[model samples]
Target: MSSSHDTHAAHDAATSHGAHAEKKSMRLMLHVWRQRDPSAEGKFVTYKLDDVSPDMSFLEMLDVLNERLIAGGDEAIAFDHDCREGICGACSLTINGQPHGFESETTTCQIHMRRFEDGQTIYIEPFRANAFPVVKDLVVDRGAFDRIIAAGGFITARAGSAPDANALPVPQVAADAAMDAAACIGCGACVAACKNASAMLFVSAKVSHLALLPQGQAERNSRVLAMVEQMDKEGFGNCTNESECEAACPKGISVSNIARLNREYLRALASSD
Candidate 1:
């Protein structure tokens, strides 16, 4: 005995409720690399995650998985993370064979779960390089980069108050290039992406940032020489110009910096002779 108007209203309400119930949770199969320590052989462990939210970031999704593991009295998976804001570059995860889950110019922390489909199988691992030995499941030793920087990444100016901006008139091109190179967070993505596992991109970016500045002019020759030498001594492979490093870099550090590195090295050799 309901009026037609009431019937339509009920239908509308039912439709709304149906839509609300349709937001089904996403589930994914994760094959995570687990290693007890540096000497232990790593293996892929399968884990099923049934409550993944599309709104959660990749790192947040991992946090949920970890919570479940700990609640179940299982050892939590170890991974690196800092700032969770994409600036720290500590979330080093190779998602499905890609450095940062195939996102262009985006780090792992910047990638959200919505990009992946339900029932997708995700394979996560650490950055592989001889210089960057696996420290744990997903953590690797990146101390080699620190040593390369220490070799010659600084300008040995007298410590004092900030110099006047007008004291040095750097060209617009040089300033822009320097800023681009300085954007590198030392993530080692370049090494992970390169077939030869070269550290050229990272070394070149570090070299370019200082070489483009006026303060870096004093030790230009020596800085490139020392940094390159340290890079070689660290067991990093040689650059074959495959351009994979530039493609995998979250900062989009250009391969042109590698060319600049070569030129600087040549100049250093010529000057030394």
Candidate 2:
């Protein structure tokens, strides 16, 4: 082939690849729920966003959508987020019928646009649970979790002289178990995804972490009783062994912790006067 013809063909191929890349980065329709207040009715509002980068995090994509809305003289979507690092558990959403979509062991804040295809229709809903009523678009009142914790989930150690780290030598097995339970981030995903909307998994993790530790031994019995009582008071349902909480938990906390919580409650009751 002539050198001029070869160069022309290469240019054509590069142009075609650029066009394909642009097509691949095209827009999508995001149907997000909007509510003015807890008592107000919510409706799905559709917004179209074009040329969204696949590398954008889910929250960043929403930011782009909000910017467009403001530019178009429309109200922006409201959502909760903090520590976008997926640690605060504030970013909660029910995306496409999954707590955090098809991604295993991830929070809503950690989801990115790469999981979705161009021109896909995405449905975003607030995490739903009786205890977590909608406060606004994609925002729910998760104060129920806080109340449960306040009842007696944590130890009551008074601050004083710093104790030696090795003063209480915990067994390796017990320490490891405690650490596993302590991994819970207090995200209400478990409650949102459960058929019964039970908070047993969250409560169990707290109960198990404290029950297994020596420093927590003093109030172990009372802690379990008080927390479980507060859980019921918060309008959370009883666990029927459906195990939905474990499947939906972002932390993958086991259902066995619920079993442990039940056992601890029973033991506490039996030993009580």
Most accurate candidate by TM-score: 1
- Report the lDDT tens digits of candidate 1 across residue range 17-135: 57654445689999999998999999999999998866567888989999999999988889888976667878788899888779888888877776788899999998889999999
Looking at candidate 1, what is the lDDT of residue 130? 95
lDDT per residue (tens digit) for residues 91-138 in model 2: 888888777665777888777676788889989999888899999888
Clashes of each: 0, 0
Global local distance difference test of model 2 = 0.83
Candidate RMSDs in order: 8.8, 8.3
What TM-score, computed on C-alpha atoms, does each candidate reach? Answer: 0.90, 0.88
Colliding residue pairs in candidate 1: none
TM-score of model number 2: 0.88
Question: Model 2: runs farther than 4 Å from truth?
Answer: 1-23, 158-162
> After best superposition, candidate 1 residue 254: deviation in angstroms?
0.1
lDDT of each: 0.87, 0.83
